[model samples]
Target: MKARIHITLKNGVLDPQGKAVAHALESLGYAGINDVRQGKYIEIDLAKNDADTTRETVERMCRDLLANTVIENFTVEVG
Candidate 1:
């Protein structure tokens, strides 16, 4: 089985890194860019084959360490 996790800042959160990237893009002459948000993507290989169990395990991983639940939201995909 495989799990993919996408961790991102919640709405209304400050994103300094994303802001820097947006500024850089503007400096490079890119136009019409409204906003930019940066995030983390993680892929894990698992021995468990059950999709339900795998998703639960990955969600636990996110809650425990992978994501900051107070400011970040994470979605898990298992296959």
Candidate 2:
């Protein structure tokens, strides 16, 4: 089984890097550029045989080592 995980900053979190990128784009004369935010992604392969079990394990991984729940959120997809 294969799993894909996305970890991103929670709403209302300050994104200084994103703000800098936006300013740089404006300096380059880009039009209508609004804003940007940065996030994280993780992919894993599981030897477990069931989707339910795989999701459970990966969720645990996200909580333990993959994402910082203090200011971030994570989602998991299994295939």
Candidate 3:
């Protein structure tokens, strides 16, 4: 099975990197931009073939190490 993970900051959290990118875009003449948020994407290959088990394992991975549970949220997709 393969697992894909997306890790992003929760709402109300300040994102300095995202802010910097937005400012850079605006400075470069990009207009009408309101906001920008940055996140992480990760892919993993697993030995297990079961989708349910793979998802559970990946979710655990996110909670334990992949994401900061207090300030970040993660989503998992398995195939």
Question: What's the lDDT for all of these models?
Answer: 0.97, 0.92, 0.96
Tens-digit lDDT track of model 1 for 4-68: 99999999999999999999999999999999999999999999989999999999999999999
Q: Which candidate is the best by lDDT?
A: 1
Q: Which stretches of candidate 1 lie over 4 Å from their true place?
A: none
Runs off by more than 4 Å, candidate 3: none
TM-score quality measure for candidate 3? 0.97
lDDT of 1: 0.97
Which residue pairs of candidate 1 clash?
none
Put down candidate 3 lDDT per residue, 1-79, tens digits, no spaces.
Answer: 8999999999999999999999999999999989999999999999998999999999999998999999999999998
- Put down candidate 2 lDDT per residue, 1-79, tens digits, no spaces: 9999999889999988888988998999997977788788888999988999999999999999999999999999999
Model 3's lDDT to the true fold? Answer: 0.96
Q: What are the TM-scores, per candidate, against the unseen true structure?
A: 0.98, 0.90, 0.97
Pairs with steric clashes in candidate 2? none
Candidate 1 has a TM-score of 0.98
Ranking by TM-score: 1, 3, 2
Selected candidate, larger lDDT, 2 vs 3? 3
